[model samples]
Target: MLVNSYGLNGMGIEAIKLFDKMPRELIFEETYVCVLNACSHSGLVDHARSIFFNIINKTEKIYTTMVDCLSRAFLFEEAQILINNFELHHSPSPTMLMSLLSGARNKKDNHLSEKIYIRIEEKFPKHKNRLVSASILLSNAHASVGDIEKSLNIKNKLYQLGLKKKIGLSFTEINGQIFKFRAHDRSHPRSKDIYAENDKISNELIEHGHQFDSAWITRLLDEDETIASVLSGHSERLAIAWNFVANPNTKQIQITKNLRICGDCHQVTKLIAAIRQCEIIVRDANRIHHFYTNGQCSCQDYF
Candidate 1:
């Protein structure tokens, strides 16, 4: 738990220190995985590699974690090689391929995305659930690069197959009470104030020279929707807006998201932390991000 907490807070070095201090007899497979995850989240790829190679008994989970570390660093060739070597002795794991695909999506590498999707299809044809996730990642990779037609095609195929995507949601706690929000949610009693706060923050962001990037938009904007409008409605943004409405003088905001935070929301959160001179910690599906007051994230832009 300590190692995971350190990783969650982007304190990889501290996590490593604890791992080293642990008694030799006490170290287990999970211990290695935790440390590798810490290194992955904190961008300590070299450290992760060293630790990974030294392990005497490498498990599928360990290889997946190492693959994730390399993938997050955009070392596609190295990651692929690791996956290939793993498959030599063991069957392929969907989790491993998904890690590489996710990294390709983050980099918007269309070619790599297609290649990885093909591999996934060839290996996991019968695995409907994993295929759904792979398709989503592949579609997102295309959408991120303005290939909306391809993205829509993937989505349409999923719909035709009757496979549903998971909905994104964010949760926050204030005054000992937890609140949940979805994209464009208006169910909260203080919905008006929350949106107004978001608008105010959006204007401040613009003043700070933050332009909403349309590349992050995955679909066509409605007549009433601008890039800013759609982005401001993201679940995490709504959660942040609620934080401000619930407490105007808040100095710290923490949120938990059910999905990976999108690129736009990640950028906006960094700017918001700087603009408000507050600390913002978001625990997304992949990892935790600590947004500091200087417009920097704990992940160091790796995410």
Candidate 2:
């Protein structure tokens, strides 16, 4: 069955309308997946929950998608309650478990995360590959709360398994050409210029009272210099600086990230948008943030 593009692209209400018009017999797993995905990405918690319970037939993905929607909306208690209620009869899928884990990460509840890790670890034998990725997430969640020991243990386990965490990378298009950047990468010919621009942005933003979020710093550097280096070498920041160098007055810049945008990157993007008078849109794994020149973001800092 053909899935609705609108739904897949975050137009949840429009997708729901079309879903309602589809022939009941034609609606299947993909249809539900499309609508639920749109609702989740767009943070339509009510719509997602309503359709979840009222739909004709549901799949495992539908449940997981609803959890993702509620989590993205910051309804952690509600999401947990829903998962508990569902678990009364059915075992949760890996995706469903990860949705709950995402909620734990967002809330920064290290205790809850430890418990969640237990559940996740119990399923390790069956989902070794997926859990390898989830382990990095668990590690980050722990590290975000300053539980560096557990975080390192998780990463060390992945190392023993010969699995390496994929480095964060971001891409942007300028003058119709794509530019890619990774953290601490200085391979670009204009690497010095990008670092200089990032340094300027960091100092200015710091002067403006933007607090440094050191969680984004994955490098082992002197604590005093780590914040500056992290900010300078961030993939999205590098991409943004490159965009400015290539077209100083570009109205907007778009960057796509392979992982979630960190708190520091989010903070810098807002300030940079205002400072440069350029709208910036960054799409990460979980959501899209539209930073306007006024230093306000479309996600309202929820992400």
Candidate 3:
């Protein structure tokens, strides 16, 4: 009724107010979760905190939801403190732990990352999911710090545990057309045309004083000669190749990926954005990284 009569903004405020008027003892875990989600959407940090504390007498699921909301908002330290002080016997759910680690990674807080890993180990030593999460975090943090060998070693350990990282891929929809590509994928029907276009764009960018940083490519390939070719096969490149083929003059491209964007890929995308005179929005595991012609990314290289 409120939405039909007053509209979205008014209805939302009215709904929240109505929920807030409920007696404290009557408020339930699901109610708290809903309020936490509202806080996340509306950026109501103080309200979220109040609701979180009020829900303390409720359930662990409510606490988990609060942790997730805080982490998603980049309040890693606060989330950590809340989780630690709760004295919950078991640690945060693996999903919550993953969110915390993701938030820390976004902030490039390796110290926090290490603490999270140690906590996970202590709390859930036999949990394979936590182990995989820790491995991925360590590998990514090591790679970010330029310790490529250590990063690869961490990945190798994960593999030994029978938990290899999923190959990252991306897909983009432009002008009602969908294009997909995986890391080093060459199975697309338009692979030949895509390569030809990528070659042309890469050459033009090089001529315009842009250098392709193929560090991730080098890490993936066993042979030195395959590095350049492999990098060209990355998902971002595939998206760009499709963009060129479908809409050569488009000013913006949006791509979504299933995993964290590699450091080298991040740098390369920024260069590509500048060279192509376009803005690229990449949604990865954590958040959106927007690249523009100013040779900068939205994350400031934190991820």
Candidate 4:
């Protein structure tokens, strides 16, 4: 709880300091998980690598965590080397591949993603979930960097395989009620108001010189001119919009996401926090990001 809380606040150094002081016998696998995570968010590459290589008889999960730490720090080559050296006791792990691919995605390195996929294919050729999911990842990475043709072809192949990309979801709670949302969602009873308020927020952001980029959006929807419309419908935005609609008295708003928070949304959240004079906390798959009303985020934009 302590390490996670520090990480959640984007205080990686504090988390690291606390974890490092514990005796070796008292430190368990889970402790390293948190420590590595803290290091990743803090961009402590040297510290993370040290922890990675120093762990005794590291388990696969620990190896994966260290990979994530390196990936988050943009140490792609080192991360791949670590993965390659691991003596696998079973079939290749899809999550590790996905993590590496995410690192590639950050750098928009399509070739690297393809190479990683080829490696996965060689080892686990028949793993349905692994292949399809990785194909989708490769598609997104290419598309994000404006290689629409490659992305579309991968999507078409996914269609041939009858695998659909899982819809990303984000959730929030208000007035003791839980709300679920998706992209372009209109099923909510107050969707009309929600969408309207979302537009209002978007207009505000644009007026402040906020420029949306394709890197933070899905390559699928980002190719079109309707990018603004698409961005307005992001689940996290909708959740925050709902809070504005009904919970104006709240000083801080916290949201939880099932997937990684896109860069576009992250930027928008920062602008929103400043404009509205409120603090927001977002817990996405990668790490927790805190948006302060002063146009600052806890993750320091590293995540």
Candidate 5:
């Protein structure tokens, strides 16, 4: 539990220290998974690889974790090779493929995402849930790279099949209370102040030469929405805005999101931490991000 907590809090070194102090005889397959996950979350791929190769009896879960580490580093080729090697001794695992697909989506590597999706379809034809999830990632990969036509096509297909994309949400705590938000949410009593603060942040970011990259947006903007308006409405941004509104003097803010942080939001958070002279910690679906006051992130922009 300590190992996982340390990793999730961007303390990979501490997690590794704890792992090293553990008696080898007490180590189990799950132990390796936790440590490897720690490495993955903290961008310690080299350490993860060293630990992984030393394991004499590697389980499928162990292999998946290592693949996740490499994939998070954008080492797609290495990740795929590892997956291939895993299949040499056992059947293909949907989890490994999904990890690769998710990495591709994050990196906006549409080509690799397509190839992985094809492989997933061929290898796991009977796995309906996996297929739907793969399609979502594939579509997101396309949208991330500005291939909106392909993205729309996939979305249309999913809609026709009665499948829907999961709604993204974010949670944050301020003043001993928890606040939850969705994109463009205005249901809160302090909605006016939240949106006002968000607008203020956006204007400040623009003055800092932070261009709102429309590519990070996965869907078409509504008639009343501009790129800044759409991106600013992201659940994380709303949550962060709420923090400042509820506690104007907050020096530290923590957020938990249901989806991976988009590239634009990642960059924005780093800048916000620096500009606002605060510490921002975000735990996204994939990993944790610690944005320090110097505009540096613990993930080193790997995520």
Candidate 6:
């Protein structure tokens, strides 16, 4: 009715009003979830907090939803407080805890990260999955602070648990064309063309005072250069290659990946963005990492 009577733009506010008009008994778990979602959509922190508190007497699911909303809003401290105060424990859902850790990492609050790690271990002793998840979080935090050895050790522990890091892949649509690639994938029909273009662009970058660091390049290249050639086959690279072939004059490419991007790929993407003078938006497992020509990334090399 709101959409038909007013417009789609007014539907949300009208829906909230209608929800307000409904008796308290009519509001349930789903209602609380919807309200929290609305708060997320509209950036209504105060309204979200009020509705979140109201649902506290309801269910753990509601608490989880509230925690998710607060975390999405980057209110990690508040989210932590909610979890701490309510003492809500629904095992196996490491999202809230992960969010808290990520928030601390973003803030460079290493002390808090250590404390949270201990708290998580103590509070959820039965959930062994937290070990891997927490380790990954700690690895990320360590990497952000240039503690490479510590980060690699954490990653190694996960690998020891038989949990290998999945390669990141992404596909982008440009001018009605879809391009795709996986890490070290060489199966694409246009593989040769992609390599040729990468070579050309890399040369131009070097000529323009962009020094390719041995550390970054060494990771991509193998003993036979075969492995290095495979790096171009990465999903992001594949998408970029496709974008290059599909669009003749486009300036930007957007790719979304399902996993946390590896260190090597992150470095390469930044260089690619700089050399091409194109905006590359990469949405990874954690957050969006936007690469640009000024040798910078949106995550500030934090992820």
Pick the lDDT winner. Answer: 1
Estimate TM-scores for all models: 0.76, 0.69, 0.58, 0.75, 0.73, 0.57
All candidates' lDDT scores? 0.90, 0.77, 0.72, 0.81, 0.88, 0.66
Residue-wise lDDT of candidate 2 within 1-303, one digit each (tens)?
023233334466788789889988898888887787667765676777887888755566777777777876768778778777777777766777777776777677667766767777786657776787567667767777877777888778888988886688999998789989998789999988888877887888888788776554433456566666766677998999888888878999999999888777887898889888999999998899999897878875656
Highest-TM-score candidate? 1
After superposition, the stretches of candidate 4 with alpha carbons farther than 4 Å from their true spots are 1-10, 88-91, 125-127, 166-182, 186-192, 206-211, 216-224, 246-263, 270-303
On residues 1-303, what C-alpha lDDT tens digit does candidate 1 reach at each position? 254345455678888999999998899989998899888877788899999999988999999989989998999999999999999999999999999998998889978999999999999999998899888888878887888899889889998999977789999999999999999999999999999999999999999888897656667778999989998999999999999999998999999999889888998999999999989999998899999987878876656
Point out where model 3 deviates above 4 Å. Answer: 1-28, 89-92, 168-180, 187-189, 195-303
Candidate structures ordered by lDDT, highest first: 1, 5, 4, 2, 3, 6
Give lDDT tens digits, candidate 6, residues 104-185: 6655555677777777777776667666667666765665565667667767777787877565678777777665677656
lDDT of 3 by residue, 1-303 (tens): 232224433433654797889887887778877777666545566777876776547577777777777876788879988777655675456656766876676566666777787777777778886688676776566555566786788788777878876877899998887778886667878778888998887677567665545334314446654545666667877887888778889899999999888765787788778877899999998899999776667765546
Error of 6 at 284 (Å): 10
Ranking by TM-score: 1, 4, 5, 2, 3, 6
Clashing pairs in 1: none
Q: Which pairs of residues collide in candidate 6?
A: 181-235, 182-235
Specify the poorest-scoring 10-residue window by lDDT in model 6.
212-221
TM-score of 6: 0.57
lDDT of 4 by residue, 1-303 (tens): 254445555677888889889989899889998888877776677888888788887888888888887877678898888787774454456677778987887788888988988887787778887788678768768877788888888878888878876677888888788899997788999998898888898999999898776655545654654778777778899989988887766678889998778778998999999998989999998899999887878876756
lDDT of 2: 0.77
Pitting candidate 3 against candidate 4, the one with the higher lDDT is: 4
Q: Identify the runs in model 2 with alpha carbons over 4 angstroms from their true place.
A: 1-62, 69-78, 176-178, 207-209, 216-224, 256-260, 281-303
Error of 6 at 120 (Å): 3.0
